[model samples]
Structure formats: structure tokens, C-alpha cells
Target: MKKKKQEEKEGEEEGRKSMILLSERQMKEIYERAATIGAKEALKFFEAERKKEYKGRADKRLGNTKLLLRNYHMLKDHAEKSVFGRTQMEESALDILESMMSMYDNEVIIESIKRSATRTAVIVSHIETMLGLYEAYCDKSRSREIERRRYEALWDMYIAASTMSPKEIADKQHVSKDTVYADLRIAIEKITALIFGVDGLTVR
Candidate 1:
């Protein structure tokens, strides 16, 4: 057993010496090949992870935006009434409300609501601004005719304060229900980008 162990040790040392004797160019070639293969596999892994993460984020974003739009007037009203002395700038009102809340007891539920309301206020403001921008974008040319209709569809469906159903909006816009649904999707995507910036973009 001792002799076998000694032989194994000798073999390891010989293998190490042989490895050390490899020419620099040969080592470089081996390293390059390993790196190339490893990098490809690593890239594939990361890309898959990125795509999965993107899908999760996109779903959350779209769902939240749709919920907000469906309850736009309620959220706007809640922010206004909940925040005392509401200003023209709803976001500023929410900011003041948050500051005031921080002065009181550290109630977890109230603090959570304050934070949610603040975020909702900011998102509401972004939605309003996005609509204004879309209006201007539509005025640029007749080429934006479809975009104009899509914009109106979104407005009537959500921001008009008297929200309409998809079928109602389709009838009002003289389009198919499928077209109305498609428009709402595009509008929500635009709002997602407006609210979340580059991170809101879909992976595909």
C-alpha cells in the first residue's frame, strides 16, 4: 500500500511537471479554447435568466398599470381626499402627506399605505403627462391617424373619468373589439415605459 501511494504521488508530480513544461503558445491556445466554450455557456445561462426576469417584470408592470387605469378616477380621488390641502401637483401633495405621516407614530400599515399612495400619485401624474405627449405626437402628421384613434381609445377607456368598456369603446371608435383590446395593450405598454423608464421595456 505504501509503495502504491508513493507511485501515485510520483505520478501526480510528473503530471504537474509536464503541465508546467507546456509552451506559452500551447497554453494560450488551451486557455482561449476553454474561455470560448465557457463564455458561450455562461452567456446562454445569463441570457435565459435575463429573459425570465424580464418576463416577470413585464407582467408585473402591465398588470399594475392596467389596475391603475381601471381605477384611475378612484385613485386620483383617494389621493386628493386622503392628502390634506391637495395641490395642483398631486405628487407634491402626496410628498407632504408622506412627510406628515413620518412625524406621527410608526404605524406599519399606515406607512405602507402612505408609500403606496405616493407611488400611485406619481404614476397618475406620469399617465397624465404621457397622454399630453401622445396628443402632441398625434398632431405631428396624418401618418399618426391610427395612433390618434388608439390614444382616444385609451382616453375614453381609462382617463376620461367615465371609463367605458372595451365593447363600448370599440363601438364609439367604430372598430372591432379585438382592435380596441390591442390599442389598450399598446397604450399600457407606453405608460409602462413612461412610468418605469428603460427598465419597463419588454425583453422581446
Candidate 2:
């Protein structure tokens, strides 16, 4: 009886070992599948994030283009002015305390404004150059009539600083309001690419 009991105990030990080994094999297979799935999911997530970032950058570029065009005249005026001299800074800060006078002399603010003015001048010059090219192109070929209309629409709406409404622009262009709006949009898209580079062009 004691020998039989010992044999039964040995059989139970062997069974437990077999079950453990089977479980380990199954776990390894599950882990491999999970890793594969996780990698694919990670890649998809990364791609989606990249697209969002790209779209965000494109939108920002478009917004900047619109802003620069709208403020074209004002920026040009600012660009023509020389940087503030020491006397000018002192005069501007005359009311402030002596201790706070250093704020007026802050090179950082002055440099930042100077840089902004320079960039504005550069962008405005690009707009003018592009418009000049467009004018020449429009005149060179009657087939580009629609393109010419779009260019005129953009100029009247922004570059000319005219107070003309969209309806007025449409009447002047001899097109529907919707056409004028579309032209303006297309013009802005083209200029956005010019100002911000090719990547500024949105997919849509």
C-alpha cells in the first residue's frame, strides 16, 4: 500500500509539471500575438498624430498669410521707419521712474520689433513681386482670364486696402458673389504657399 501511495504521488507531480509547461507555451504564443497587434496600433496612432500636426501647421500658415495681407499697408509704413534712437527712447519713457528707465532701453523688445518689421517688408515685397508676375502673366495670355479675375479680386479685397465689400468686388469682377469668394480663397491659397513655402499648401 505504501508503494502504491508513493507511485500515485509521483504521477500527480508529473501531471502538474506537464500542465505548467503547456501554460508557458500558450502564454508565449499570446504574448507574440499581442506584441504584433500593439505594434500596428502604435504605428496607426503615430500616423494620425502626424497628420494632425501637419494640418495644424497648414492652418497656422494660412492664418498668417491672411493677417499679413490684411495689414500690408500698415506693415509697410512701419517698415519704413528707422529704429528708435536713444533720445527717442528717453522721450518715450520720460514719465517712467529712473529705476524703470532700463525697460525702455531693453534691446530684446527693440530687436524683436525690428525683426518683425523686416519680415513684414520681405513678405510684402514677395506679395508685390507675385502680383506683378501675375499681372504680366494675365496680360500675356487671354486664356488665363479666370486667373486674372482671381488676382484682381485678391488685390481689391486686401492689397488695395479698398473699402469695397465682397458684393462690390463681385460686381467689379463681373461674377457672382460665390465666384468672387472662391477666387479670393484660391488666391489666398496660392499666396500662402508663396509666403510659407510648399508645405504651407493644404491637401484640400
Candidate 3:
């Protein structure tokens, strides 16, 4: 058993040495290949998470829509009541309508902004809202801008992940396949920036 262990250790040492002696190009190729696999896995995880989030959002939106429609019908019926009753009903209807409109506007804005934004921005914004930043920020425009920056950060992450796929990233980054791996380090820095909000990328 000891002899076998010794042989295994030697083999491992030889392998390490060979790896350590690899040319820069060879090492980069290996790193890129490994990064490609890691990026694909990360993307799959992200996509699954997004799907779950979308389903929850969709269900909530549907329920709100139903509630809005019910309120609308109730308000319409009350519109034929006595003056005081009509006024009260009208007020209630307006409240519900306002709530519905606010939700509608938010959805529209999210959709429009997301189209041009990065995934990082969307994720960060969603996280911030979930954390009750809306209450703290109290300004819709400012909140949306924060979300936009988050999206840009996410885009940068995506770009970095793409760089792992050397062949595709080579052309995209306008660099040779041999040099594309360098971008991975740059990407890591960008991701760190996004996470840390070092460049005022995060909303306060």
C-alpha cells in the first residue's frame, strides 16, 4: 500500500510539473476551456432562477389584474347610486384605478428598460426593490436609473462570461484567441465592481 501511494504521489507531482511548464498559449487555452464550461454552468443556473422569478411575477400580475377588473365593475354599478354614495364609490374606484395604473406603469417601464439594460442591472434592481429600497429612495426616476446601471453591470458580466468561449470571444473582443483569455481577469474585476458597487453602480 505504501509503495502504491508513493507511485501515485510521484505521478501527481509529474503532472503538476508538466502543467506548470506549459507554454502561455497552452495554459491560456486550458484556462479558456475551463472558463467556458464554468460560464455555461453559471448561465444555466441564472436562467433557471430567472424563470422562477418570471413565474412568480406573472402570477402576481394576473391576480392584481383580476382584482382591478372586479373593482372596475363594482365602481361602474355604484356610479348610478345617490350623490354621496356615487361620490364615495367614485373615490374608491379612483384609488383602485390609481393602484392598477401604477403597477401597469412599473411593468411597462421594467420591460422597456430591461430591453436595453444588462442582466446585472435587472438582478440588482430586483434585489434592491425586494429589499425595500423603494421606500428609502422615494423617487421612481432615481430608482429606475439605479436599475439601469445594475443592468449595465450585468451586461459586463455577460460579456466576460462570453469571453470564456475563446473562439466566439476572440471575434467579439477583437482579439486573437491567444489573447482572449486575458479578458477573463478583466471580467472578474468588472463583476467585483458590480457586486461591490465600487463605482457608484449601486443605488444608495
Best by TM-score: 2
State the lDDT of candidate 1 residue by residue for 1-204, as single tens digits.
999999999999999998789899999999999999999999999999989987877666566556556666866765564443335344552343334323433344233333656554654565677678767876685868788888888899888867789999988989999999998888778766665555666667
Worst 10 residues of 3 by lDDT: 195-204
What is candidate 2's lDDT per residue for 182-201, written digit by digit as tens?
99898888777765557768
Of the two candidates 2 and 3, the one with more favorable lDDT, higher being better, is: 2
In candidate 3, the residue pairs with backbone N, CA or C atoms under 3 Å apart (3 or more residues apart, or in different chains) clash, namely: 118-151, 120-154, 121-150, 121-151
Every model: Cα RMSD to truth: 7.3, 10.4, 21.8
lDDT of 1 at 151: 80
Error of 2 at 54 (Å): 0.8
The CA lDDT at 161 in model 3 is 29
CA displacement after TM-score superposition, residue 81 of candidate 2 (Å): 3.6
Query: Model 2 residue 68 lDDT?
Result: 60
Model-by-model lDDT, in order? 0.69, 0.67, 0.43
Of the candidates shown, which would achieve the greatest lDDT relative to the real structure?
Answer: 1
Is 1 or 2 the stronger prediction by TM-score?
Answer: 2
* Structural similarity to truth (TM-score) of each candidate: 0.64, 0.66, 0.30
- What is the number of residue pairs that collide in model 1? 0
What TM-score does model 1 achieve against the real structure? 0.64
Q: Which scores greater on lDDT, model 1 or model 3?
A: 1
